[model samples]
Target chain A: MSFNVIGKSVIRVDGLAKVTGKAVYPQDIYMDGMLYGKTLRSTVPHAYFTLDTSKAEKIEGVVRIFTAKDVPGHNAHGVLFKDHEVFCAQKVRRIGDPLAFVVATSEKIAQKAVEAIEVKYEELPAVFDPVEAMKDEIKVHDGTSNIIYHYKLRKGNIEEGFAKSHVVVENVYKTSMVDHAFLQPEAGIAYVEEDGTIVVCAATQYPHFDQLEIAEAMGVPAEKVKVINPAVGGAFGGREDITLQIHLAIAAVATGGPVKAVYSREESFVAHSKRHPEIIKIKTGADKEGKLLALEAEIIADTGAYASWAINVTRKSGIHVTGPYVIPNVKVDAYAVYTNNPFCGAMRGFGATQVPIATEQQMDMLAEKLGISPVEIRLKNAFTKGSETANGQILTESVPLITCIKKVADALEMA
Target chain B: MKKRGKGIACIFYGTGYGNGFPDVSRAYAELQPDGKVAIYTGATEVGQGAKTALSQIPAEVLGLTVDDIIFINEDTSITPDAGTAAATRQTYNTGNAIKMAAEELKKELINIAVKELGLNSDAGLEMKDGKIYLKILPDKCITLAQIAAKQSEPLRTFATFTAQTVQIDPETGQGAPYWPYTFSACAVEVEVDTETGQVEIIKAAHAQDVGRAINPKMIEGQMEGGFAMAMGYVLYEDLGLENGRIWNNKLSTYIIPTAMDMPEIQNIIVEDPESTAPYGAKGIGEPVMIPVGPAILNAIYDAVGVRMTEIPVTPMKLLQAIREKEKQGA
Candidate 1:
């Protein structure tokens, strides 16, 4: 069981090439006869829009201007739900929706052409709040309910358990929308090879997933398109979803040459997904000795314009609502709602991050009511070797919450 | 006016895809005629030291130095799928596959060495540093060069390791969602500027159960890096949005912690080896950031006697909380 290098610190194999500035990112990619691509985004949050590219087609050096009618195959794709449009055909549900794409010989020409393209938009009522969206008065998407997904977890009887409680605390918590803010703005380049195969090199987290999605959108087989990720500046779950992969593929195939698109910092913020903004309501009850008796939680997440990872986030929120604590009776419901807002998806913590702010605060509240210190209350309710989580999984090993808290508490005391 | 206070938070994180996803990592190892090794996998480096940790595993198992290992990664057309480098599964799942492939190649080499040396049993033979030596008779050794020189075919093997987990109950959200979990706790000491509502982090300590440290220095880098990112998430970073559109869309408008903003960090690595992982390593990439925001929030509460519930607890927000508390007292 001895190892010479398994546990030893060795120099990174790719460090020298990166530190020496020899790393070739997707942005650095340049091919002869390449066309720069630019997207015209919707100005209004929600509206029915009609695009007119006749004026833009006359712009000098503009190769082509493609709209929703120009897409070869499927115009929509998403990580979880295929609701996001490559080019909006009728209605723009979010401000980031792509209305048209411009391909030109130069970036300036493409941008200028995008600005020249005329469009008329008829505004529609939009719902911005998840709770209000749940009312379904103004649905983000027509025909379907605003609630994208709802998950429920039922444990022991909440009524009986709450009746046995000596103290109860109720609270509501709100988490703000945060961007990934990765140093590298979303960038990619795509081209159709001589062999009629499409190739895409981009800053992405999942190349395989990107390949399949890109191929499907371009009306080609998965093998026809290849995705390669060069040196990424940073991706704290920001690159998990599709960025510029498909847009470049469509432009490349349509322009009959290499196509490159790099979002500016402002466009990058509007283009990519952000961490889900959620509102969590929690109620926890405990006995006089600080033994957790009952827990009830309802988490509503603003999934924004699409259901990218909304279902996954809501389920995870339901699973970890108790926050490393042991409770007998627990009931939880998590809902993801569609809204005409900035779309939210995976981030570093996923669903587990926001719920902790509520649960931990609830823990501290219980501590105050029980006349015990924060450390004592957490230790009292901490899951041990044989404890069962709110998700009903029995802990077998490596359950070290108590030990870790004690060490941190001890370290803080020493400091 | 400045006052000092401390707070602590502990949290658990799972490693691997979890949620009953078929999480698998596959690796291919081949021994070249020149005694070097080549490993092919789709694990992206992503500045996470994946290439280094992955190289170390095959090198350790095949009795070769890390310099002898060549990695072909990040190219889907060539490398086998090792699953994405996210979820901190590189060292655990991919490490196991690389080890298996290297061990398979080593078994073949040991058989060849036994036959070449005219040894009676292969049990006494051990490969170390590109040479096969008899433990009982160290002088009787054969180099990999000699074996490859006389070999009929090159040695190559493939391995795939799948995480063992159960699907959770759809309604209850209960089951073996993840194979193994990583636990981490962070404690922070903060000084609050009562007038300005700016909290200064004096020192911070983070202790994590990584199951095992494949590379202590790299794990330290992950800890400190996660701390810095989480610090920004707590105190500085916020994507200012108005009416569903980003207001501070540029980095110049948004704020993040620079080198000068980092506090003194005490990185502690707790090694509790997991039986299911490669060399007993459970990944620590994500767990390192889970408890950080809560820890700093608790510390701010302790210092200012106000609980700021939202993230990016800006100075203005703290000043408002302080004023609200004062108004209540008045």
Candidate 2:
């Protein structure tokens, strides 16, 4: 219980350098002869396009222009799936999809070169709603259904438990798509070392994963790539996926010099992943004594453009749908549907943040119907030691929901 | 006309990459010639105090202050893989890995000290402030640096920690997918302007079972930050996406909470330590934000008898709901 450093509030180890403006973020890093890199993104959401890099290659300071054809290895990278293309070769799924990458002597020249490249495309009909996309009428990907992933959970029996309940409350809840807004926009620098190793310095949540991903996209061994995270501005979950790390690496490998890229605020918003917007339809049943009986819920999430962390996010939703209470009979179906909206991945709370809006409200409604208080109803049904979850997992240790509830209630003078 | 009311919400969240994911972390610890320690890991510190909290673990095991430890992290070549910093896993996963490596180094140093002192057995040996001493006799002590000079090989250790979890059955969705689930509760008092449908939080109270508080100040920082983010999620932050394009891409248009918008917050830390964690500490990063949204929404309903189903409950939407409720009452 008592110790030297375990529970002490020692000042942050990196606090001095950060406070004195001595912390070197990725943008602060400048290498000699570092060419500026920029990507030409698609303007249309859905299209089959032909890229013309002839004009871009003729730019005055443009060193090289990389299209999908120039990729030496697999032209795709994603945290969960390899569905996101490094450069949209033939078809573009989202408005911010990369069409070409340009490395130039200066940032201004890179921008000019990116503008010089042309894309001629045929736009296609797109689905923007997850519910509508689930009909499978319009496919985001060519050969797959619009439903990216679906998870179902069945426990005990929903019908009999619901029939035995004294009261049932049902409502639909919606949560909006939001960004991490981590203050600093994405920036990175990459170059080759003396021993034929490509070193990338960036602001990321996982540098080891970036090393593997960059190596895979560059057609090299994992050891051929090295990633170092500078002083990160912030990353709630936005930097969990690939950003400018791979692009900078590929450009550096091609140019055989350092390549640097920094995303503007607008570009950061359009390029990175957002939190999934969820539509949850939940029905909760409880006995007259305030004990939760059965729960049935349907959750649909919009995983736009590509599947980033959709599978795990939606599965987490289904698993935590019943909240912290003990619901014996449960039937839940969660789906991550593909759409043409901005892609969604991991956020702070992952998938669990959205459902409590409905579940907690239902508990209040149930308490109102049963002529009891909200705190009383929750305390009656909240999980304790040895309680079985909706997923049949037994809560053995550190089950302190009741204690937390009491503490909060006492602080609010509601106890 | 303003009405004030109180509401409460609670949550239980699982830590780490559950559902049979590997969820592993590795760390390396070395004893330098100067007797200072070096801890290497790949856990990225995204301003969440990961480097500070992780350094505390090795220092605690080796009986050294945080200042005496050289923390090296977030580089792929030098540091071993400590997994991603998401899933709130760094403090539990990497902290344990570094502690194990430091424990190994500690055992080796004790062996060296026992041999140098020509003791019959390595008993009652304790390390503190860079000195190895026997428990009963205060005078019998040796500096760790002196022990380091006696070692034939450099003292270095590597350790890896893998969390145990079972994959859920696809058909039934029944399994112990996560271990050591964290719990939290929040209560908020809100004042609602009935005419304009404006809601202001008067006061907020939050309590979390942190498993153990490695740094209480950092835990409070996380709690306050989480409250601000959840407030934005429920009432202010909205990405105006139209036809796949973000219209309000700039921060000026897309609003977030400022310090002035925050109300007085009461953070209550409860320690119900997880037995398997390092120093009985679990992650408090993500769980702090989970209970705020619903608690604020419930408080709004309590203030005014209206149930707003959608998020970022703008004044326009709340006013519309208020008008509808008045119409029904009439």
Candidate 3:
């Protein structure tokens, strides 16, 4: 199929602006009389804290100091659950939980005020491991189990398929928690228009969701809020959740002036979400001909302090546990557990990135035990056009695993 | 001693907010007075070339050049909600929505042309290069600007596209949670320094079923960038967390792969067009990264005959594993 523009490599619409250093990222934005905002987070991971903001309020350029009491609307916001707190009212669940927000006339003043705010806390026991958090003795969230969600998939009978298998390979795999490390740190500017509409300009993956969230936090109608996205540096799923949008909006509305907040590199690391650290135990069985027969896998993921996209991420891991092959009999259990560790949310691959670290190694192990080559074994069991996934989704079209495998293999051979 | 080996891996990924989430994208198309069209959508570009790719959809449908269309996006009040740019969904979801809105606007323009030119029917009419013409007659044509000037009412359209997916049953985890899953594979060759346990990637060959190639160069860029990120995921880029606090929060301490660390990369794009997608294109953003990590790990195992069960396989961990393997072999 030939066309004028669809397939052609037209220059990027954002190319000139980006290359010319003319693109205005959130950090590059500045407004007249804009107050700088900074957050005061908890020093202890789990604690009951008493905040004294009197000194911060008395700072020379300090405009306003906001605590849990100043928030007009709901203090909680999250992508999946409304459990994350805008300000820690009673107990701090994680290390970076916001205890207070300080707005000042300058970034230096804001930093000074944030440092002046005194927090006295009584530390509590914290569980950092997902497996240990599952014991429910020390709950990440009080009065609830730490096992946030569990997803299970059952296909054919596992015992029978394993019994028929000539060789079985089992191993445990682990992946670490990593940062998105997008070039731009979290930054935004928020101000109220003359007609009482709050406008937030930020770097984000979704501006509409930000509008809704900012409105919800301000106890106002959605129509009263507007969000504009400037040129984003990078996201890689890091900007999918809330960052400085809500705090900036709240500060702007309270002070009745334009407010801006830009997280430093350290603050950005402490504030945003990380990729889930996963532990996967997988067992694969194949026949003498190297055809995959059955699989049993268990995955436990640390979702950290709050439920972000844990339900979807772990469920995705469960669905793709069998990899790109037809495993007739499969049993998989995936869990997203909450711990006192840094919160884990969306990343580039969501949950599918971690499973291949296990499934692919299992395939190679099975191939080695069966006296077959890696490429040959995968070819024998790769999903074709009519293959059914472990989750019972029948791929009717565009199932091109074999073609991709062959293309890579052929390219490698040529190289 | 240094050892060399090769390994391969494959993966399949479902696009959008699957599992029966109402993955919807909305867009608006307004025909300007000068025959130019404006597309308004809430899809943020996020440095992924979404604006370029999405602008092409309306341009293709309206028989105009990319420069002829005004791309307005990411303002909540002005543009309709095109969903988030994550989930690798902008091109497929927002592209389809823009295409639909543009198609509707095209139909309205053809109707105006039919009445203005006194055409017998709209069946033989074709739009190309800013003109609506009759295919039967070589020269019976009217400019879109002329039709715009003659219209009594303004020409505008709004469209919404929702991907079809069945929710997986909560208990059984059965049912189709996603529509139009994308597939990919990768092969990598590596050299492992046995004494120090430092592994260097020699070359990487990757292939993805992109459904259709909207822009082959952009797809290649995505593939190459995804490979580098995935390589970092396996070898470097550790957050260094201890008891919930990031010890190495600075960029200097938490090492990401620099340009010097990248290996030679080869991208193979397979165009197996998805029938439901825009121009038969599926998202390749996230799928390209999924297979590279495993392929690199598999190559490491093949090189040294030691299986690494954990990631960000720093030289220290690899050395420890190699020592343990040697102890067992002895």
Q: By TM-score, how accurate is candidate 2? A: 0.98
Backbone clashes in each candidate structure, one number apiece?
0, 0, 0
Question: Taking candidate 3, what TM-score does its chain B reach relative to the real chain B?
Answer: 0.97
lDDT score for residue B23 of model 3 = 98
Judge candidate 1 against the unseen true structure and give its global Cα lDDT, from 0 to 1. Answer: 0.83
Here the TM-score of candidate 1's chain B is: 0.97
lDDT tens per residue, model 2, B236-267:
88788889888889899888888998999999
Which residue pairs of candidate 2 clash? none
Model 1 misplacement above 4 A: B116-120, B138-142, B145-154
Cα lDDT tens digits, model 3, A282-321, are 9999999999999999999999998889989999899888
Report the Cα lDDT for candidate 3: 0.90
In Å, residue A18's CA in model 1 sits off its true spot by 2.0
All candidates' lDDT scores?
A: 0.83, 0.90, 0.90
**Candidate 3 lDDT by residue in tens digits, B1-330:** 999989899999989999999999999999888888899999998888898889888999988999988899968999999999988898899989999999999998898888877887798899988899999984889988887787677688999999988899878789998888999999999999988888899998999999988888899989988998998899987888888888889899989888898888889999888889999999888999999999999999888988999998998999899899999999
